[model samples]
Every structure is written in C-alpha cells, then in structure tokens.
Target chain A: MAATTLRSVTTYDLKLAAPLALGFLVFFVTPLVILLALSFQADPQGSRYGLTQYVHFLADRFSLGVLGSTLWLGVKVTALTLLLGYPVAWLHQRAPGWGKGVIMLLVLLPLLTSVVVRTFAWVVILGRQGIINAALGGLGLIDAPLKLLYTDSGVVMALAQVQMPLMVLPLITALSRIDPNLADASSVLGAGHWRTFRKVTLPLSLPGIIAGCLLTYAAAITAFITQSLIGGGQMLFMPMYIYQQASTLQNWPFAAAISIIFLAAVLVVVSVFTVLGRLSRGYTNA
Target chain B: MLLTRRNLMQTALTLGAMHAFPGLTWAQARPLVFATFTGSWEEAHKAVLVPAFRKATGNADMVLDPMLSVDQIAKVTAAKNNPPIDVMLHDPGPALQAVAQGLVEPYPVEKSAYYKDLIPAAQEPTGPAPFFQVVGLTYNPETVKTPPTSWADLWKPEFKGRVGITNLNSTLGTGFMVELAKMHGGSESNIDPAFKAIEALRPSLAAVAANPGQLATLFQQGQIDISPGNFNAIQILKARGVPVEFVAPKEGAIAFKTTIHIVKNSPNKELAFKLIEAALSPEVQATLMEEPYLIVPTNTKVAMKGEIAKALAKDHAEIASKFVFQDWAKINEQRAAWIERFNREIRV
Candidate 1:
C-alpha cells in the first residue's frame, strides 16, 4: 500500500510539471539547438557546411578585440554597480518603516523607466554642451567642454546606472535576511564596526553579491541599445558586432557562430561565480 | 410563436443567401500586409498612398506593418515560403540582396501605368525605385560662417572637434566613405585613400551619430557645426527653426534610391502590385515630396516647384551632373569588412 501511494504521488507530480517541461522544450531548448546547428553552416550562398564561420571568427583580430573589450566592459560595470549598490541596499535594510519604503522606491525607479529614455537622458547629460559642461563653464572651472559622449567611459557610466537596480534588489533581499544580533555579538566581542562588516556581514552576503554580479555582468555584455546610443558605434562591443554581421551584412552563419561563443563565455563566468559563492558559504559556516 | 414551417423556411433561405454572397466578408478576411519605414514615413504613406491605393483598387483592407528595413528583410527571409508581408520597401543595397536571395520578385513594369513616366534610372531589374534621397554636407549656418563647398572643408583647423559623422552602419555613412574615396583618387575597389582621409580628420570629429535622429539632435544642440547627412533630415530640422543648411559639395552628392518590392509568393500579389503602382503615381509622389518625408519623386510627371525643388536634386541633368551612384551589389559585398576596419582603425 505504501509503494502504491508513492508511485501515485510521483505520477501526479509529473503530470503537474508536464506543461512547463513542454514549454521549455518548444521555446527555449529548440531554438538553442537550432542556433548551435546554424553556427556550423557555411556563409550565405556558400556550398556545403563546415567550421568556416568559427575559424574566421578565431582568425580575425577585430573579432578577438571586440570580445575582449566586451568582457572588460562587463567587469567594469559589475564592479561599479556593486560599489554603489551595496551601501544603498544596507541603508534600506536598517531604515525605519516609511524611510525604508521610500529608499526601496528610489532604488526601483530607474528599473521602472525605459532603457532607451534613460540612455538618451545620459546622452543629454554627457554631451559636449551638456549640463555638466555648462555648469563647469559657468563657474569658470574649465575653458573647454569635455568630450564625454562616444567614449568608453560614457558607455561604462550609462551601463552601470542601468544595471544598478539589478544589483541592489538582490543585495537587499540577502541583507534583510541577516540577524541584527550577529553584528551586535561581533561588536561586543571587541571587533570594530568596519571589521564586523568585513568579517561577519560581508561573508553572509556572498550569495546575493554573486547573484547580483552574475546578472549585472551578463546584462552589460549583452546590452545593445545603450552601447549603440552612447558608444556611437565607435565602441564596437560584441553584441553590436553580432548585430552588424547578422542584420546589415545578412551573414547569419557568422553571427550564429559569434553568438554561440558568447553564450559559452557567459556560462563559464556564471559557473565560476556559483563556485565562489559555494566556497564562501562553506567558509562562513566553518 | 413565429416558428411555423413557412417562417423557418424563410429564415433558412436568408442564411443561405448570406453565405452565397460573401463580398464584404471576403474583402475583410485578407488584408494586404505592407512592411515599410516607421514614424513619419509610415504616417506619410497612411495619409496619401493608402487612400490612393484603396481608391484605385476598391479594396479597403490594407494594413501597414511598420518596421526597420533590416527587421523587414529578416521577417521575409524567415517566412519565405509564406511571407507575412505582401509588399516590402527597402534601400537599393538591401533590395539587391533580397532579389539575389529569391525573397522578392521583379516589379511588373509593363503592367504599371506610370512606368513610362518614371525616369530611366528609377526602374530596376528587380524592383521599382520610387524615390531618391540626396546625401551631402549639412551645417549649422550660425556657427559655420562660410558654407562648406567640398567635403574636405570639414577638416579645416577651425572646425576641429566640431564636426559630426554618422556611423558606418547607415547608408549615409557608406555614401560618405565612397565620396571620400572619389575625392582622394580612389574607387570602391580601392578605399585606402578614403580610410587615410577619414583618419586624418578623426581629431575634428565631435561625435559619430548612431542614427539620423541622433545626428539631428546633435545639430539642434549645437554640438556639431558640420556633418554628412540626407537632405530630408536637414529640411525637417530647418522647418523646426534650426538654422541648418544642406550643400551639394564640389565633389558632388551621393543619391541613394529607395526601392519598393513585392514579396515572392504573397497571397495578395495583385493588391501588392496595385499598391506599388499607386505609390509611383504622380499624386502620391507629390504628397511624399511636399512635407515631412521630403522624398524626391522618381516620376517625371510630378513637377516639384519653388523651395522644395531647389532643396532637392531637380531633373535628370542636375541628377546626372551632381549626384554619384554606387554599384549596390559590390558595396553590399564589401560593407561588413569596411565597417569592421573602420571600427577598429579610424573610429578608435
């Protein structure tokens, strides 16, 4: 009787999960399979299929530069967001009722706005005759307007702002779950505030930091519109390169090859973060 | 109470008649899907061409599916066997690719009444060129005391860090590259001179705009005093009270043709043809040329007079003498390599 009941429960659970499994198979798994297959195909109008696309991407110096720059941009944006977001998340956790609500709203406001609008706003703020330049000029701090738009710094700044909310929300969730007594115990045990934060609070927040970094880094690398608007196509990131190859040039096979490689790079980075998070958790428990 | 045998028979007859004559229902069932430019371009078509097409064909079921040219091409390519779009509009470069890929069929020129009236250059082997956009030097009159007479004027010492240029992804950018090549004793096959000239002028570039809208905004904000762009965009900016001017450089302007194509194996092939014919008609051409879009008409029958004519390339003589055309097929083949090189070397 016990065996039959267990079998029935397993079958029922499978039946309940069937829709989601089918959806994943049809939507996600199938397209990825197609993309992987397309990566090996020859360029348009070429005869037969081979590894020509991948070979070309590997051989080209421009492709390698774009990939390296993309990874660098991802890292810079992720680091900037963490530096700015951690404090805001911590403050939100310690604030009083209404104050906490207001801070939370402020943190979420940017995410609620359209990315294109935010990017354009950054363009206005960062242009040669933009507000910063105007202000500096008015005060006689500088004679010449600064060249801010269409530069690597411009792209990084815009990306960090866009990806900050992603980092803050995750950190807030993790930080709120920590017990206040742990910090009190550390303080009573002769540790300074900074030391307590660095040893106790920081280690406990590792999972959230890892999650936030992974999300922000992946989003920064794959971002197209913000880079296109601010970088002005001069800063050719991998996503822009992929778009140019696919849409403007109509070279789908090469684009597919680049996309597959990008996917692999993202997966490797995410796996490393996950392992680091696990190690940090083990150390904290010990 | 009315369910007598005679009443029931009368109701049955009415239902049979409704099925027999499905004129209204049939027309409503299949709307002709046209994929074309978005924003003001789509608005212009809806205002003029859609009504004209409906009047000519007596078919009121036509839908305008606005999309970017690249997105339109992708959609048609994906659904080649049963294309979602009945008609497609694109620039000459992508239109040639579409023809080569067998995604579109040639326009039936013999069937179009306005075919004879179209300028010789407007008719293509694969599609009909309905309009032309002239790309040249656009400048702010307030800042640029002397109007630029040639493309080389942008590299003057006084204009350092004041000039803007579009990115290589756009047609205007490609045209500017070809113009530079011609000015420096090179052709499409030999673009080294062009690259050298652009690199020399790199220090003068204030920004490289990603799209026409961004380019216009830069001009409006006075961030750039000079740049290479289309006449239509300059005209629109001028109308909005921006003191900008478009000049035909001594080296000549590049004329890019906009092509209208009928997607292959479309369900509404006949309606699509009629729509293309209507777009080429003199009335619709004049409307497109007048305001908002400011497209130069390809139909010779439409006589653009006054300020609008002065702003555009007028007549065959002006077009032949002052406008340069590129082999789109060859340009398309080399575009990716040139853009990659530009991004790595010049734009850096």
Candidate 2:
C-alpha cells in the first residue's frame, strides 16, 4: 500500500514539473544549441561551417582588449555594490518596524525605474555642466569642470547603482536568517559589540554576500545599455563591441564567436570565485 | 440551415478561410507595407506623405512599419524569399549596402516623373535621394565671440577644453575624419594624417559625444563652445533659442543623403514605386521642408524663401560645389576596424 502511494506521488510531481522542463528545452537550451552551432559557422548567413570565426577572435588584439575591459568592469562593479549594499542591508536588518519598511522601499526604488532611465539620469548628473560640476563650481571647488562622461569611472558608477538592489536583497535575507540570540549570548559573555558583529554576524552573512556578488558581477559583465550610454562608444566593452559587430558591421559570425568567448570567460571567473567563497566560509566557520 | 455538428464544422472552416484570405476576399484592397524611421520622421510621413501618396495613387490602404534602419535591413534580409516591407527609407550607406546585397531593387528612372528635376548629385544609379543634411561646425554664439571659419580652428588654444567631438562610430565622426584627412594631405585611401590631427585636438575636446542629442545638450549647457555637427541638430537647437549657430566652414560640409528604395520581391512593387514618387514630388517635398521636419528638399522645382533658404543649400550649383560625398560602400568595409583603432589609439 505504501509503495503504491509513493509511486502515485512521484508521477504527480513529474506531471507538475513537465511544463517548466519543456520551457527550458524550448527557450533556453534550444537557443544555446543554435548559438553554439552558429559560433562555428564561417559566414553571416551560415552557408558554410568552420572554426575560422573562433580563430579570428583569438587572434584579434581589439577583441582581447575588449574582453579585458569587460572583466575589469565586472570586478569593479561587484566590489562597489558589495561595499554599498552590505551596510544598507545591515542597517535594514537592525531597523525597527517603519524604519525597516522605508529602507526596504528605498533599496527597491532603483529597481522600479527602467535601467535606461536610470542610466540617462547618470548621464545628466555626470556631464561636464551637469549637477555635480555645477555644485562644485558654486562652492568654488575648482575653476574648471572635470570631465566625467565618456570615461570608465562613469560606467562603473552607473552600473553599481543599477545593480545595487540585486546585492542588497540577498544580503538582507542572509543577515535576517542569523539568530539574534547568538549576538545576545556573545554580549552576555562580555564580547564588545564590534567584536561580536565581526565574529558572528559577518560569518553568518557569507552565503548572501557570495550570492549577491556573483549575481551583480554576472549582470555587470553582460550589461549593454549602461555601458553604451555612459561609455559614449569611446569606452569599448565586449557587449557593446559585439553589438556593433552584429548590427552596424553585419558580422554575425564574428559576433557569435565573441559571445561564446565572453560566456566562457564569465563561467571561468564565476567558478573561481565560488570556490574561493566556499574556502573563506569554511575558514570563518572554523 | 440545421444546427448539426457537420454544419457547425463547415461554418467554422469557412470563417477560418475568410480570416486567412482577408486580402483575397477584398481583391481591390491590399495594404502596401513600408519600413521607415521612427519618432519625428514617422510622424512627418504619417501627417503628410502617407495621406498625400494615398490621394495621388487612389490607394488608401497602406501600412507604415517604423523601425531603425539596421533592423529594417535585417528583417528584409532574413525574409528574402517573401519580404515583409515593400518600401524602405534609409541613409545612403545602408541603401548602397542593401543594393549590393540584392535586398533592394533599383528605382525605375523612366517611371519617375520628377527624376529629371532632382538635383544631379541626389540622383544615384540605385535610387533618388529625397533630401540631404550637411554636417559642419556648430558653436555657441555666446561663448564663441569670433565665429570659427575653418574646421582646423577647433584645435586653437582658445577653444581648449571647450570643444566636443563625436566618436568614430557616428557619421559625424566619419565625416570629420575624412575632412581631417583631406586638410592634412591624406585622402580616402590613407587616414593616418587624420588620426594624427585628431590626437592633437584631444586636449581641446571636452567630451566625445556618442550622438547628436548629447552634443546639443553639451552646447546648451555651455559645456562646449564649438563642435562638428549636422545642420539639422543645430537648427533644432537654434529654434529652441539655445544660442547656437551653424557655420559652413571654408572646406565645405559633408552632405549625407536620406534616400528611399523599393525592396526586391515586394508583393506591391508598383504601389511602392508610386509612394516613393509621391514622397519626392515637389508638393510633398515643399511641405516636408517646413517647420518640424526641416529636411532640405532635393527637387530643384521646389521654391524656398525666408529662413528655409538660409538653412538649406543655396541651389544645385552650391550643392554640387560645396557638399562632399564619401564612398560609403568602400568606407563601410573598413569602418569597424577604423573605429576600433580610433578608440584604442586616438581616444586614449
């Protein structure tokens, strides 16, 4: 009787899961398979198949430079988001009632706005005669307006703000999951508040930190709009380069090859970071 | 007449056939599909050209699909056997590429009544250009007391950190590059002199604006005193009382043509040709040259007066003598490599 019931339950689970599995096959797996095949094609129309595209990308110095810039941007954005998000998450975790709600709302506000709108706002704020320069000039900080737009720092600043929410939500969840009693017990044992936070709270929040970093890093690397708007086409990142190649130049084969390389590079970086994160967590726990 | 299952199935089948063959049901009506620019260009066409074309041809059914030029080309190329677009409006570069790729059919010169009236420079073997926009030096009159007379004046010491330039990815940038190449003894084949000249002007540049809007904003905000840009953008800003002036430099401005072409294998080729003809007609051209659309009419038959005359090229002679045209087909091949090189070497 028990075995029959178990078999029925298993069948029901499969029936429920079928739609999602089918969706993955159709939407995700199919496109990826097509991309992989196209990456090997010799021409834009895919009339012939060869490894020429991949070989060209590997040999091209411009392609390599773009790859380096993309990786660097991803790292910078990840670090900055973590630094800004961690404190906001900690404060929100400690806030009482209405305060918590307000912080949460503020954290989610940027996410509510369109990425394009947010990036444009940054353009307005960072331009030569923009708000920052105006204020600085008013205060007599300098005689000349500093160049901000069309620079790497401008791209990083916009991307960090755009990706802040992804980092904060995971962090807040991780911090909330830690028992308050652990902090109380540490305090009772005469540990200072700072020490208690450093030892207990920080270690407990490792999972969330790692999750947020990975998510933000991945997004930063693939970001197209922010880089395009802020970089002003002067700061060439991989995604922008790929877009130019495919659309303006109509070099689909080259674009596909670049995309494959970009995906591989992202995977390798994420894997290395994941292993490092695990090792750090283990050490902290011990 | 009876409410039987077989009768119901037959009725459903009949309805489905009607749905699928709506055009067939109405043999006299088939909508011509045209792919064109979005925003103001689309608005201008809908307001004037579409209705005028319909009235002239006695075909009231037409559909305008607004998309970016690249997207339009991609759609036509992807659906080569049966193109979704009957007519396509694009810049000269993409139009040449479309013709080269066999995505578009050449206009029938004999069929067009206004073809002879079109400015000789506007006449292309592939198609007739309906309008042209010139790119030259634009500056803030308030900051620039003495107007810049030449393109080389951008690098003058007084304009240091007060000039804005577009990156090489844009048409304006490409034009600037060509102008520089010409001024410094280099030509189309060799742009090395142009690169050196641009590198020298880097210190004077406030920013490399990616688009015209950004350049306009920079001018409005007094972030830039001078920049190389198109007359249309400068005119738009001047209309808004932005204290900007468009200057035709001594070395002539780059004239970029906006052209229309009939897509190959179009189901409505005749209607498409008619529409293109209507757009190029003196009546339609004159109306489009008015406010909100300020496009320079290519038809010599169209008369201009007042501010429009001052804003546009004086006549066919001026257009022939003052405007510089590039070999877009040849330039497009090396454009990507040139842009990458510009970003790496000159921008740095």
Candidate 3:
C-alpha cells in the first residue's frame, strides 16, 4: 500500500490530461500572465517601459470614469432584461400542452441565429430609410427622421433584445422547478395571487435572475464587434474604449491597464451578485 | 504510461537520428505570414498579390492573416518584442502613426533602382515623416454625369445626404475633414472650423463609415450621389459593376505619399525587408497599382496598359496644386486630444 501510494502520478495516470494541461498553460495562461505583467510597466514613448503605465491609467480622468460607464450600462441592461424577460418566462411556464412545443421553438430561434445578423436587421429597421422610419414618417409622428440608430436608447434596446433570451431561459428553468401545487395551496390559504408570487415564485426564482444578471453583465461589458458595428463610433462604452486602446491606439500597456481595471470592476460585480444571492438565500455556493 | 518502454526508446532514437542528420530533412521549416486589411482588398491580396509574390520569391507555404488595419496595428505594436507578420499592407495613417510611435525602422533604399523610378512627389517624405502611399479623393464616373469640377463640389446641394463620410475618429475621415477644411480655407492645426463646416454639411452626408463596401453598396443602390473615396476604393467599386468615376478634384485632393518601413519589433526583419525590397521594386509597385487592386504606384514608370495609368494621371497636376499635405509628425500625438474634442463637439 505504501509503495502504491509512493508511485508517481505521471507513471500511473492513464489519461491525456498532462499534455492538454500543458497546452492550456502555454496558450492561455502564459499570454494573460504576460499581459498582466506588462500592464504594470511604464512606456512613456511606448518604445520602452517603467511603472508609469499604471500611473498614467490612474492619472487619466477618463480611464477612472470607464468603470462607472461600464457598470451603468451593465446594470441598466440587466435590469431592463429582467423587466422584459420575467413575463416571457411566465408565459413559457403557463403555456398550454399543445402550444408548449411551438413556444419552445420560438424561444430558441433567436439563439440559433448570429448576433451580427440580428443587429443588422435592427439597423435596417431603425435606419432613416428603414421600416420604423418609413412607418413613422407615413403616420406624421415626426417631421424629421427620429435619430434612432446611434443613440444610448438604441444601444440599450439592442443590448437588452440580445440579452433577454439568456435571462429568460434560466428564469423559465427556475420557474419550472417551482411546484404549481404549492402556489395553489398558498392561494387556498387566503394568499392573493400577487401575494403568492411575492412570497414564493419571485423568491424562488431569484437564483436564476441573479445568475442570469451576472452572465449578461459579464457578456455585455466585454462586447466589441457589436458595439463597434452598432455604436456608430459614437456611444463608446468601456469595452469600446479598451478595444480602441488595444487595437486603434496600439497601446498595449494602456489597454491592459484599462482591462485590469475592468477585470477588477467585474470581480466587484460578481462579489456583489454573490452577496445578493447569499442575502436572499436564493443561490447555493456549491 | 500507455506506451511500452521499448517504444519510448525507439521514439527517442528516431528523434536523435533526425536531429543528427539535419541535412536529410527536406521540409521547409518557416511559415510565411502575410497580413493585410480585411474584405475585398484581402481577397485580392490572397488571390493575386500573395500568389504572385510567392511565385516571384519562391515561397510556397504562405499563410494570409486577414485583419482590420486597427487589428494589424495592435499586433505590430504588441508583438513589438516579436512580430508574427512577416509582411503587412497598411494605410497612410497607421503606417505614419507607427513611424511616429517608433514602431517602424528606416527602410534603406537602393539609390539607382528606387530613386530613379519613384515619382518626384512620391520619391521623398511628404511631411515631417515618410508615408507609404499618396491618398487623394476618388469619385466614380458612372455615378457622376457632370464630374465634380472642384473639391468644393462635394458640398453642392445636389449631392446632399448622398455623400458618405467616414467616422471622424479615424485618420481617413479626419484626413477627409482636414482636406475639405483646407478647400474652405482652414487648416488641420485649427480643425474646429473644419468640424463646424462638416456639421453644416451633415444634412448632405449619407453616413459616416469606414467600410469601403458600405460606400460601394450606396453607389450600387444609387443612394450615394457622390463619394470621397481612396484611390484604390474607386478602382474596387468600378470593378464590381458599380458605375463609378474617379477625379483629382479641382482644388486637388490631398497627396499623402506613403513609405514601406520595417516594423522595429518584427522578429524576421531580414526577410520582411526582402519583401519590402520587392514592394519597392518598380515591377511590383506597378503591378499593385495597375491591376485588380488598383493603388496609385509611387514609382515613376512601372507600366500602365492603356487608359488605366492615364485615367489615374488625369487631373494630377490640378489636384497637386491645392493638395493639403497633413503634418502627421505633430498631429499624430495630438490625435487623441483632437478626437476627444471631436467626440465632445460632434453630435452623436
């Protein structure tokens, strides 16, 4: 038994884990570690390095404000998604037996298509010569074209539309887990329908909502191609700013510093989500 | 653990034997990484440019790394320590901006071969720094019944809302703005007047875009009445069944002669410069400019089949007189501040 325990894991291991682990270390971890390391170094001319790179990021007012913008967009997108998603999820839960299959297919359709194609569809619909503009123009709602494509409202609407499905799926799963008989019992016990929802359904579904919010916020904050394509180079959120730094400006240290700051903000958002989860008793850590 | 002990020893022996007799290895060891901006330009580079270069240089295992100019700049800057791209095709702003950032190294010229063949204006640095290509205004003839007689024609009420402008954040758009401002008697040093002028013309603008294809689409649909295009973009649009014509606008489009400098941080500078040397060659320069990807060549005499070079040459003298040569050396650093101000002032 002692000899068996003493044997090298490499000598006895039967899987290909070691080689794949090595590949991940070389490909993913090394690049990230290098970037993390370089973010700290200062490059005044962008030709050489010191610790001033971080100092520069810290020193710049815009870089500091990037957090607020990112968080504001994230929270707004999440909240809007939740408001729009809950009803759709409720509908899914309350669907008739025959309608269930069709609704299920409908709910999954947007997920099957590419985000870019969907966004382009929105662009055409929202464009000057597009459907909405044409319809609005015909109705004499506004004299001039309502500037819809490149506004904050446009960004939020588009973002929420894309994220609503993510919010709904998890919510439907959570809602499905709640026993309908429990709600019936609560109502029979003299609780109103609204009261039953407040007391049971909302509380029970909080886990999925929190998980979904975290996922949406994480995905929304890091968006690049979507924002670049749709933002019209005007409504630059933190991700767009970071991308311009990393890409357009070609300042890796500055870009990495911005990313590091963003990463820290994401960590705080996650921690807050965890705290919310724990306080509500809606999530299990395991 | 899976392999027998004998097999392991045999593997080691084979590896050792291969290492010992290196001359016996017939396989080429290096990967040819050629990068260019994405879209039709990339397709052309892949279809014709890279293949021709490979055939000429005898490099067969070449890989194309198609990316946006921004992405290419990032790679060149990030991999400043060691670059993946052996050759790259970039615009004037990025190429000049790279030089300003010290990401580019001076390209040594072969006096007789390069100096004698390059156009007088394109042969030397146009600004405080050197550039890779001379950029100017190009419009399609098929779209214009009466071709724009002057640079100021873009602002005429007839072309209102049919003109596609680029994003102000980009060098291309900013360059266009600066040129327009100069036509209206303002300078890049005071870009405010230019911005105000552009704002006044916003009603006439179709869209502020970067994609050449978007402009092409507008032209194809007859939505774009006029386009302020790059010399190559005009050529690309014409090839795609778009009724387009190019002009050297009356006040003359700005002339930005570009240079092909070796990226300072590239790992394979020796091979890169050889490619650069090929780029400098009159034969290659002429080929790049006169064919499917019709860029204006810097070389004085490459060979223009018939009307191609002459068409490119039309209005050359007129556009040259009033051309605004941008001072990238100073402006490159101030670009961020200019862009910030532009963002604050420009309507979203």
Q: Identify the leading candidate in terms of TM-score.
A: 1
Which pairs in model 1 have colliding backbones? none
Cα shift from native, residue A57, model 3 (Å)? 5.6
Candidate 3, superposed: residue stretches over 4 Å from native = A1-37, A45-67, A96-98, A138-144, A282-286, B1-28, B73-82, B97-108, B111-115, B121-164, B180-227, B234-248, B255-292, B303-312, B315-325
Candidate 1 local Cα displacement, residue A160, angstroms: 0.8
Chain B alone vs. reference chain B, TM-score for every model: 0.90, 0.90, 0.78
Across B51-127, the per-residue lDDT of candidate 2 in tens digits comes to 98889888657989998777788899889988988899887667777888899888999878999899887887577
Error of 2 at B312 (Å): 3.4
Q: Write the per-residue lDDT of candidate 3 for residues B1-348, one digit (tens) a residue.
A: 689999999999987877777445554334556676666556655765566657666875667788766676667766777677766655566766665666665655543245555555555331111123334555546556788877567778887766766565566666777776666677766666777777787777665553444555445544456766766666666777767776666555555654444566554556555555556566665666556766555555565453344554533342245455676655566666666655545543
Predictions' DockQ, in order? 0.56, 0.51, 0.23
DockQ-sorted candidate list, best first: 1, 2, 3
- Comparing candidate 2 with candidate 3, which one achieves the higher DockQ? 2
Across all candidates, what is each one's fraction of true contacts kept? 0.67, 0.39, 0.15
Count of steric clashes across candidates, in order: 0, 0, 14
Residue range A185-283, candidate 1, lDDT tens digits? 999999999999999999999888998999999999998999988888577888988898888888888999999988998889889999998997897
Off by over 4 Å in 1: A1-12, B1-29, B314-316
